[model samples]
Target: MEGQFTGADVFFVLLGAILVFAMHSGFAFLEVGTVRHKNQVNALVKILVDFAISTVVYFFFGFAIAYGTSFFVSASELSGAGSSGIFEAKGLTLVKFFFLTTFAAAIPAIISGGIAERMKFAPQCFATVALVGVLYPFFEGLMWGGNFGLQGWFESALGAPFHDFAGSIVVHGVGGWIALAAVMLLGARIGRYTKDGRPIGIPPSSVPWLALGSWLLCVGWFGFNVMTAQSLESISGLVAMNSLMAMVGGILSSLVIGRNDPGFIHNGALAGLVAVCAGSDIMHPIGSLFVGGVAGAIFIYAFNLAQNKLKIDDVLGVWPLHGLCGLWGGIAAGIFGSTALGGMGGVTFASQLVGSLMGVAYAFAGGYLVYGVLKATTGIRLSSDDERMGADLAIHKISANPDTDIMR
Candidate 1:
């Protein structure tokens, strides 16, 4: 029985890993298409760089930190659902590499909105390093790693165990917070706001980019949420169904929230996916959709508040869509999941709130520190000249419009 369970875990892990990989292209298209034509190449560069950096950092140390049984202790004693037997083996190492690679790639863009069209490639890449190599694995072990030793606030709240089937808190929350940190450190894009504190409209360069990227993300997220369910082959049906329902819920929610906003139309479905991710495997289909609806509302509101009210420059709306909505998923997991189906404790709305908050504080604080250092040093932002001229022409010496006078 033990051996069979182990094999199933291996299968799900690999499958989930593939699902995450598919998201890179999803993010690429989404981000690039959303930005101005002048900075298209830079947007593409940011996504690719995040992907590559994660591949390297996760392979070398992030995997060991995340799945490693023992960092201070020993490899044999690390945590999470995956087998410790494969912890140090090169083959398993490769598997962990792919799983985390997608995660690492996802984090850099939280700052994307703030730095759009102006950020230098090098600093953006460096930001990826902090999130992927330093921040992610530490918390990942704390949440999902079985032998994590449970020293943090988690132990106080969770006692012997805290469940994160597909990393609503660990993966999405962490990425969201890190992205938020980057936004804060990097600051808003030029012209994002007026002197009177009103926001200026910076429309997405292409509607196709907006719609297609959103669709791609919706598709990729299935892998992100569903792969976690493969752990129980016989019961995979329920798990996958839950994930599917959550997306439907998310879509329906978009209609309600975006009643007047086209942007909401673009993100309503995504909010649903991110919302359901944490509890997809354990929740009933109804619960999944409910969570997604709630998330869509939150995503739309957060983005507006950030732009119109707080004046935070989130170019792609990454912070609200992923960060805030992901938070909804994390807490919802505790509320919606059935302990019976999930093999853990059942949901209690309140306790789940506490769990999600813990994840937010840790990720936000850790990410802020990384950004603070970068801010204090080489400075993690672009010059005003670069901002106005566009990142491609200024940084890469390539103009989006070759017909422009400077290029000619």
Candidate 2:
């Protein structure tokens, strides 16, 4: 019976890993559909390549930093071939690594959206390696891994530890904030603004593809949230239900608030999912709906504020969708994950607020320092001539649509 349960745990986490891994395709297609046709290929290439780099760096460094686990030992040791303890779960540790690596890789995927068109490939790759290797894992360990006793400190001070059922702040919040720093450092895409500073509109390349990306992300997110259990017995139908309620709430709110803009409608779904991730297991379905509704509205308002009012050229509004919403998710977990709010109570608002801010500050500072150094030294953007030519041709030496080649 113990052996059977251990095998089930392995299968469960492995499935979650596969599902989250598939979401990388969602990231690629979303970027592909959002950026101009001339830069679409670069969008696809960056995500896949960054993910590959993240895997190597995370395997060697990030995992150790976050979990204090190393796989440098013999295969038998890693697989627990002869052990009969927690380590003897038939190498379930390795499967857990696969699941968490997908989460780590999302940092680059999120950043890829914001700095899409103009950033150079190699510098961004370096950024990915450093981010997944150290910066992201440092925070991840603090929040999830009990590293440095941060959660213990939080609980001691605030009467409860910070509770993130999945990774609203740890993954999405960090990714979003980091992307903001990179985008600011990289600057807006050429002609995204006028000489007088009026924001120019850049239309999406393909709404159909964008919608498909949203669909894929929404589907994969169940695995992202539910699989946080990592075992069948611990999994909650509540998490799945809350995710659904929040998703639709985001959709409906964005549809209304965004005035039927297909882009907002599609991305609105993501904003809710991002928010609910923190407290999906604790909140009631109705509370999840409210959270989703607020997230959808926040995405519309914040995206506009970032792009138009702030003149930040975050192409997909990643900061608003992931960063801001993730911040809200952390805080909302405190609100909605309480006994008075029809939730399982073990959280505090002050703790959530502090933790969320800490994540944002850490991510922004790390992103700024890393990209700032690269900008001053190696240079992060394409040359003006290359920018005029588009990244697809300048970096990849190919266009998304080869039929245009014949016309040229």
- Please give the CA lDDT of all the candidate structures: 0.70, 0.94
Task: Report the poorest 10 consecutive residues by lDDT, candidate 1.
Answer: 72-81
TM-score of each: 0.85, 0.98
User: Taking the tens digit of each residue's C-alpha lDDT, what string does model 1 give over 203-267?
Assistant: 88887876787787777776776665444453466556766777677677777777846567767
Task: Identify the leading candidate in terms of lDDT.
Answer: 2
TM-score of 2: 0.98
**Cα-based lDDT at residue 19, candidate 2:** 94
Off by over 4 Å in 2: 83-88
Give lDDT for model 2: 0.94
lDDT of 1: 0.70
Candidate 2, residues 1-408, lDDT tens digits: the string is 988898999999999999999999999999999999999999999999999999999999999999888777778778878453334558888999999999999999999999999999999999998999999999999999999999999999988999998899999999999999999999999999999999999999999989989999999999999999988999999999999999999999999999999999999999999999999999999999999999999999999999998999999889999999999999999999999999999999999899989999999999999999999999999999998899999999999988879798
Which candidate tops TM-score?
A: 2
